[model samples]
Target: MTGPGRGTTADTPVVVAARRTPIGTAGGALRAVTVDALAAPVLAALAGTLGGPVDDVLLGNVFGPGGNPARVAALAAGLGDDVPGMTVDRQCASGLAAILTAAAGIRAGDGAGYLAGGAESPSTTPTRTWADGTVYTRAPFAPTGDPDPDMGPAADDVAVRAGLSRRRLDAFAARSHARAVDAQRSGRFDDELVPVGAVLTDERPRDRFTPERLARFRPAFTPGGVHTAANSCGVNDGAAAVALVPEWRRRELGVPGLALVSAATRGCPPADLGLGAVPALAALRDRPRSPDAVEFTEAFAGQALACLDAAGIDGHRVSPDGGAIALGHPWGASGAVLVVRLFHRLVVQGRGETGIAALSSGGGLGVATSWRVVR
Candidate 1:
């Protein structure tokens, strides 16, 4: 709960290093890789630069085989058996939740350093069935009596309620792809990426998507819905992790990083969960200034636009290099991917002094974290 104004500078948690695997579409290049396998390389990449032991390893995972994937990944990454690990699950917000949890622990004087992030492998996730031989794609986000629409339909509802037109949504999606393609060509994503197997770059961003092509697609969720496959993120497989240390330790290591300023998580109506990020961003306290750069998960163009509009943030201020709409969304990993992108932009590229990473999740959850570049 402690933020910049509430805590001493020396004790503030900072992200010294961040890395992520190239996101791959489900059943594509990363199909053979398990969740732990996808996470191990990213963890190893961060740990290799630390030069000291990590206090713990924390990972966010959804739909994994579930034997403590964090611990499995730590061992696979060769981080020594002494380093303990824990897994967290908060649907799509899991990754950001893990990072915030680590920062909270550091603020509480629990540990000096930690490894936290998220990983998801939709390609290798197993099918689940209830004891009564009933099959289900995912667990219910709300109780039986409450609204629990699937994400696609929920996105459609957001578009309808927010008065977002199909054309506007399509344009946003096309712009996302165009920006990602441009960033890719400019080598903007080169340094943050860690090769997984033979996958070196994100597999989802296309070279182009004309408005006419995007308009030809039919509604994907409701009969008259504005949501479509092109405007939504793809199911993906990938992992991302950050090396978190207290400010004192960051100074000792002599590395630039992101100083944790504030973090918040909020809840909204389950029926309109796609708009969750608005409330979360509003909950942050002691925010000294508006973020110069923001990395918001673009799970669905309509949902993203609705949230951004409600929050009174300009679309151009978010994900200048594109977002999940182009990069693909690997469930648990998507939130961490946002932070990784911010780290690259704020710390590596020296673009801004402050930045934010925000995402909306299933079950009406939203999470937002603010950081300042510590050079």
Candidate 2:
């Protein structure tokens, strides 16, 4: 991997705008919102901030309709038929992967503007049927001949390996709710959020959550496991999108933006997949120095704790405005949600000049990307 400073150039990807729909738990307010409907408004909102036409539109999705959501969203967003679009599905990493993929194109001098993000509607997730009319809930996340442990159990294994205790996990989950509540009360999320009907705020954060209360829930994965439903991410539906442009275009537009510094993805054993981000970030030879903050997708309290420990980063440095545990993890959109959070912290709030967003996917894969705020 090219060391830190690898892509700091005129042609690097620059983020001009970022926005997201209010996150809703599965079967909640957003359940009625279709995948394309969820994404189209976000795409339009992003384009409204751009000075000119967007060259391409890319969306990441997991359990929505099979048709090209990006194309559908682009057209529904009124971007016209001339704009090309595509959808990406890398499980939980789809959103961030889509952004990084676009960044690669920008670095290659592909186009002046690109809109990339992720959208998911687990509430509306479809059931599959075979020719014999038997319905199936899911496809295997791992290749044949590989052990495909359930994600919660895999996270339990990671917690055991990382020596995280139940108390710590509960504490982490509690903190997430507290931080999210504080961010909400402070209105820190207003600018980044595009109102979705009557639900202007995320629907998952519990103002009454407490570690003591969290300790009462039984383990959801395995007997004697450290994880509980209270600490793991809830099934959610949401969408997030970002506008990317080359550094030259950003300057010409006179907009403050974040520079896409570096990005990488790594793989590990399927059973230990939640630890993927650790190796992925460790493999990065050139991460920005003295990162002011980090945002890792909160798939589970145990896995997030383990990754934070392995990366030698303080757990406090992550998700100051709350995380998936408190906010909701719309799988396909969680990765881009991390980037959107980073943009708010690094660019909007000016808390730091540089930040990194990372996540581990279901199929034994980890993805990480770094950005530097450039005004």
Candidate 3:
């Protein structure tokens, strides 16, 4: 990857605005909200802030009624008929992938402005069945003969391989919840939230999970695994979007934002999908100068700890305002959620000058993006 701050200022891609709907657990508060419905308000909020026509709208989504949920959301948001939309589905990395795709376009000088992020309403995802009427929960992540364990089992394997103990994983999970609860109590999330319907705050993140309490739960994925339901992220519904433009446009608007430094996506063994983020972050070559802020999607306590350890990142330096483990992981939207969090910390709050957002995805894929605060 190119060194940070290597590109011409005029050609750099900048994120001007970011927003997200309150995350609700699957079949909970957001159960009635469809994928398009969840995204429309977020898109509208971003468009309203930018006060201009969007050249394109890109959204990441896992499941919906199909036929391009991004297009449906754009139309629903009242973006002009001329505006086009694209949907990305890289599993958990979809949101970040969509944003990076838009950034690539801006760097290529293809468009003046774009709206990109991810949205998901797992509660309303349509059930699928084969022609013979056999039901399937999800699609295959690897070809036959390749190891493609479910995320829970894969996370367990990751912890076992990394020699991470259950106590350590439980502590991490409890910390995530505690931090999120504190942030919520302090109104740290108020600025970035876009209320959908009557939901004003995240529906997860209770202060009840101490490490001692979490230890009471039995193994969830394997017979003697370190993973447990309490330590893993919950399936949820939410949407997050960001307004992107070239540095020239941002300069004209005089809006503070995040300037894209570098982004990378890498592949790893399907069986060890949780470690996917390690190589992706390594590819950025941002060593020697650590990012002042880092946000990694915490899909599971064990998986997150394992990845951070392997990547040589200090676990305590990640997600100071908590993470997916506490906020809830709306599969398709989690990666984008990480970016949204970074925007809040680095640009909105002036907490840091440089930040990194990274996440592991199904199918052995990982996505990472580095950003610098632009005032």
- Compute each candidate's TM-score over C-alphas: 0.96, 0.96, 0.97
Worst ten in a row by lDDT for model 1: 1-10
Error of 1 at 286 (Å): 3.4
Please give the TM-score that candidate 3 achieves against the real structure. 0.97
Model 2: weakest 10-residue lDDT segment is 1-10
Give candidate 1 regions above 4 Å deviation.
Answer: 1-8
196-252: candidate 1 lDDT, tens digit per residue: 978899999987696679999999999999988999999999999999988877777
lDDT of each: 0.89, 0.88, 0.89
lDDT for 306 in candidate 1 is: 95
In lDDT terms, how accurate is model 3? 0.89
Query: RMSD of each candidate?
Result: 2.6, 2.9, 2.5
Model 2, clash count? 2
* Model 2 per-residue lDDT tens digits across residues 294-328: 88888999999899899887888788888999999
Error of 1 at 13 (Å): 0.7
Candidate 2 stretches greater than 4 Å from native: 1-7, 130-134
Cα error, candidate 1, residue 55 (Å): 0.7
lDDT of 3 by residue, 1-375 (tens): 222233437878899899999999999999999999999999998996554669899999987668999999999999979999999999999999999999989889889789999999989888889889999788899999888899999999889889999999899989999999998999989999999989999999989899999999999989999999899999999999899988777777877879888888999999887888989988975442678898999999989998899888899888898999899999888888988899988889888888889999998899988888776
